[model samples]
Target: MSPLSLDLSPDLFPALTEAQADPDGPGAHRPALHFGDRSLTYGELAATASPLAARVAEAGRIAVWATPTLETAVAVVAALLAGVPAVPLNPKSGESELGHIVSDSAPTLALAAPGTQLPPALAALERLDIDTSAPTTSLPSPGAPDPESPALIVYTSGTTGPPKGAVIPRRAIATTLDALADAWQWTGDDVLVHGLPLFHVHGLILGILGPLRRGGSVRHLGRFETAGVARELSEGATMLFGVPTMYHRIAETLPDDPALAKALARARLLVSGSAALPVHDHERIAQATGRRVIERYGMTETLMNTSVRADGEPRAGTVGVPLPGVELRLTEEDGTTAVEAYDGETVGEIQVRGPNLFTEYLNRPEATAAAFTEDGWFRTGDMAVRDPDGYVRIVGRKATDLIKSGGYKIGAGEIENALLEHPGVREAAVTGEPDADLGERIVAWIVPADSQSPPTVDELADHVARRLAPHKRPRVVHHLDALPRNDMGKIMKRALTHD
Candidate 1:
């Protein structure tokens, strides 16, 4: 898709051109964003953003209190228009975490909704109010800056240490969104709907900016709800994006709510990401609404690696092929690259080289240097297996999801998927514990559908043995009322324990 060049476009948001062409054209008057009772058309977005863009251009790097609001969207748009890098801060981050981000990024100013009460870390910075309804004089798009220059500084979840700032370039944003558009057949006419936070890539880059880049409209629910999804889809919205938790809620209520099921059935696309959507949830939604939820794979460092194409078979357990212009490989533990899986079960660490990758970790040269190979490929810590047809199925994180049991390399993801198929299991997470004989023993943590009569360890182990293999069976089982989950609905396996 244009030779995989970092020189993606002279103008990042090309759709803004429509605002200049016709002040009252269809594109100009078209709805650009909807959050609760508030909305901003394309015309309004440009006019409001242009003046703010000019204001922010001189502020250097700016911090955006990324609440899911129209003003937050405008703030980011203005930053991009002015060629200033924006760092989005998650409102949910604790004081210490926020302090780490604030100091690590060292933004010159913090921008937020007029009334947002930022924490001490952000409050310490010079404050700029982002007024979405402010009067404005629209200016033409700025001449392109270095495509490789930092456009955004996104913080990681910090499994190892304080969160590192990932420096995402403008080229990566353009390349990733365009590649996704090609895979999903995205167009200007597609009205997208979701209720995702504005801090992460899935929510901000893909959820909000993706729609804006395509010249389409987005209706944010302010927060995700089954009814909001239903209402939006039934009333002409063509696409829906959400995490597994949102879809799980949808699947749980679909049997009793025929209206919700009917509305979901009418939507053009239902996409899930941030984590794998359980096979049970996938099948339940499909059974009720004939809609197969497609999954894509990405991380903070890599914008998006692969996605199931709209025209391709929407497989239940795979993240499909790599997007156009992205080169992906599965590297064996020994360091050799494996292009295709010969046995269909061999797993390796996923590494990618593409324009859709971040340039560096903001201030940590050593960490940034270690993130890539000598030849330029970014070594993604996630492990996955590639099929003969090039479809990728992520098994788990390289550090946590890969389990060495009885001399067999097993992915915790497949075991978790199999455990979820059991009638008594409502949620499942698989992990490995040190075993004297087996090197590492398989362990299963389950949140039972019927907690009072939870499935026994023997019965669950036998179930996994029958479905998968004896080596893959869990040797130990832990039952919890609810598995610990992060904000994105990802199971926090590190927090689970048999103690």
Candidate 2:
């Protein structure tokens, strides 16, 4: 293999150009996306992207609150090829919130499927032409575009409250694709199974960009159904990138289908991200599918910085070591940054400096500045510790996800894990709520398993108190039918806190 090219000269458009040419060929006429009966090939995707790119060029800044379908996928790429910043908006956001985002972005155009309600302001713009037909020719090769130009504006998960858009430059895409092409072994020969939502960074960048840039085909899912995913695996797609929830759901449905096991066995890689991959789920997937999930850590601000590989033993409760071109550092509680990796028990703020980090939050200069340290490393608000083997375990987020009671820091993730072990619990989200005497207290919102009653707060607290330190046990619990999850299936802790 050729030495890894670190020049970073190739932008997304140029990368697409390369994908269109060479051994993979610019116009292979092979499949680009498949969701149920719809299958788009490279040539057709390029054809559709061209006119849409032309439309985007006319609009300048285009935002899409599109449903997670094949059309939404191609429209985003088309906007990028047109040299515009495409912001993927959640389809489930309310009109008030959608109006706010549309008004803030002030997009020149917005695309929506028929009958889908779009903000009046966005509705005034030209609607995207829905054409699932294949392209007549591959995207034309063009001169290298500016590598530093803004490619897309991705929003934060709003872990705190309202989501903010983070401006990711063209270089960010190139950097991620290059890294994954080596790190994750993406190549022309691979086909990725994509069950992630297009609006989220994991699904948009890593799920879409990384695979296409390397000339590999992507088989998409219109909606994530366990049976649909099982079907894709059975179809012989060699790779997959999905959130932990997707893996868990698939594990739930796969045990009854031997075909699912056979298909998963044929896959060369399976990755979990967007949220923590529980230690049990990690082991469960490996045991059930005969393939260990390559768990990694990343966020909307940065596309991807670290990964555990297909060749490595996936460490339970940890997101594997940093990927190439990623620099990891730990700042101690006293404000000293530790250059060396810390043991698994030592807690510190996780910092990363890498090519994949976003340029800035679109309009929030203060938020952008606050996101990084003095020397420019992005201060990942996550608290983590690196074990002796260099695997990084995410202890908790620095925000509300940490429960502080009796003067001890307790990770909601740990408590959530303990709750999930109970046979009665189907899902859970742990949060810290204001408590007069303790400053803050642990509270759990649980989804009870089918035909089983939810465990009482005292019962869960007692169960946790047996395994965890006294201060780590929950003080309150509420039983619900399901935890509120976002479009990507990540538990909405903010919503839980609001409730």
lDDT of 2 by residue, 1-499 (tens): 2245654664564434544553246454566777667767666677667666765676778877667677787788777777788878887777767776776677877775556666665676666655656455554533345777778887775656566888888887887777767767777778888767788778878777776777667888777776666677777788878887788877776678777777777888888887887666766677887788787888778888778755566666778878778888877654455746565666677889988889988778999998888888888878777788788877778775656677776667777777777777778788988899998988888887863656787888888788766787888888787788776677877766544
TM-score of 1: 0.97
For model 1, what is the alpha-carbon lDDT of residue 375? Answer: 86
List the pairs of residues colliding in candidate 2: 20-25, 20-26, 21-26, 44-134, 44-135
Cα displacement (angstroms), candidate 2, residue 8, comes to: 1.6
State each model's CA lDDT, in order. Answer: 0.89, 0.74
Cα miss at 461, model 1 (Å)? Answer: 1.4
lDDT for 423 in candidate 2 is: 70
Candidate 1 on 304-383: residue-level lDDT in tens? 99999999999998999899889899898855566466456898999998889998999899999998888888999888
Q: Which ten residues in a row have the lowest lDDT in candidate 1?
A: 1-10
Clashing pairs for predicted structure model 1, backbone only: none
How does model 1 fare in lDDT? 0.89
Best by TM-score: 1
